[model samples]
Target: MSVLQRLLFARPAAAYPTHVPLTGLQQGALTVLSALGALASPRRADLVAAVGETSAGPALAALRRRMTLDPRGADILAERPRVTDALLRRAAALPPDTFGGAYAAFMGTRGFSADERPPVRFVADAELAYIVTRAREVHDFWHVLFGCHTNVQGEVALKAVEFLQTGLPMTALAVVAGELRLPAEQRAELNRTYLPWALQAGAQAADLMCIPYEKHLEDNLDELRRRYRIIIAPATAGAAARAGSPTPPLGAAPPGFEGLGPGVEGGTAAQLHETSGRLGPV
Candidate 1:
């Protein structure tokens, strides 16, 4: 990046477009710098900029291709569903076990808002912008499906899985950088319990970004997992702390991610409660 570009990105308050087009070299520069900024503060605007710059194009193409192959996925592409505040509000009123209800409950309990995700920027193509936009918007839904918390550990682990699933360089960078910053015990837990499960689950599950989550808010969470062929990893020790669950510590699981579906290995459930458990909203 030029000195002027660096100066422009240095101030988070600087106005940047929602769709700032950039060349390959400019995007690469932004990705490196923004990745550094994101590591320092995960919520930094520049970091979000890096993620959008690095991951948007290929992810859009991948989602487009995957959507083309599956009937439900194709319908999602045709309709271009979005997760909006009004939609989340409607989901909040759903029965507790439903996907939307669980998502609302997760957000409410964690004091997170559905509209907090940064808008897509730096991708000029309208359709590609929408694809990346959808990816960012539904990130929290991934947390709910995979039972990951918004904590450092949870976010890092989720990033690892996201890298595996989306082939996004930014997510891969996040996983490496985030893991290096974790405390020793938490880092050990990630390596021992989360990483393997995440890889397996991410690999086995359907292309999550292609799913029309907006259309299935009323569906049962477990049924959605089954439909998507998702296999959630074991919860970390922090799961209960985040959820404030009252279940026996030994066998407890998070509310929405609990219960084994047909595709889930029976042993995975046993492993979930055996480890220290953790889960919260993203």
Candidate 2:
């Protein structure tokens, strides 16, 4: 059997999987794909606008009825050519201490030390590729919106929601893989607290990827909560942190990433690892 398969099925005492290394070539490919995805999608800006228009139609219609009117969304609608490179560049220059910076560094700290995550060393071409990439970048905001910590149950809940919303295969993988981290009661709580909410919110709310998250960084969490009809499950915060227990300490400053301090406020530090091993970009 291959080393990875062994690592996958091996029993470890830590209650989570050990870190598995990836070869150099495999790493190179995913980076190329992420970059090419960022570049090749000449329609990226168009797709972003289109997704928002299509996905948010119902939400907008309802919003119009309940609230007087939102000229901001309409203004955004009037402006075509969504999310330009210039815009992304301006966004990058914004403080790294904010949520945006943490997202920018995902491929670095997020995947295994041995294998950098997407747009790192390889890339892929898929439908909704840019949308998928955007979803990955703002994953944490979803947590913040849900008032969730990085616990296994929360991750599973979000993944299940993503699966239902976008039908992304990777999200389904996350749902199944994340299940390994849950204890019996926590798993049950996941089913009760997060599952239905994820389905309803994911289906009902607008396509998050298309929404200009950067614009909302300073927006009141309460306002977002009210509009979306979401609940931050009060089941308890420790559940996710316990799952943070691991064998390999996350390596020192991840490469391909700028050192931004979460302490700096508005900047974020994101860490993504799993029981199976670190998630590689490839």
Off by over 4 Å in 1: 1-17, 23-25, 39-43, 236-282
Show pairs that collide, candidate 1.
236-276, 236-277, 236-278, 237-276, 237-277, 238-278, 239-277, 239-278, 239-279
Question: Model 1 scores what on Cα lDDT?
Answer: 0.61
* Top-scoring candidate (TM-score): 1
True-vs-predicted CA distance for residue 234, candidate 1, Å: 0.7
RMSD of 1: 9.2
Maximum-lDDT candidate: 1
1-282: candidate 2 lDDT, tens digit per residue: 678755444433321132123333433343345334423442233222222222332333343332223445344333422333344345344444343333333323433132221321111222222333344445545654554434465556666665665554445545654554455675676667667666776777664544566675444444555566554434322322444521111223211122110111111112112211122210
Residue lDDT tens for model 1, 247-281 = 11221233534321122223222222111111111
Global fold similarity of model 2 (TM-score): 0.44
Q: Give the Cα-based TM-score of candidate 1 against the true structure.
A: 0.73
For each of the candidates, give the backbone clash count.
9, 20
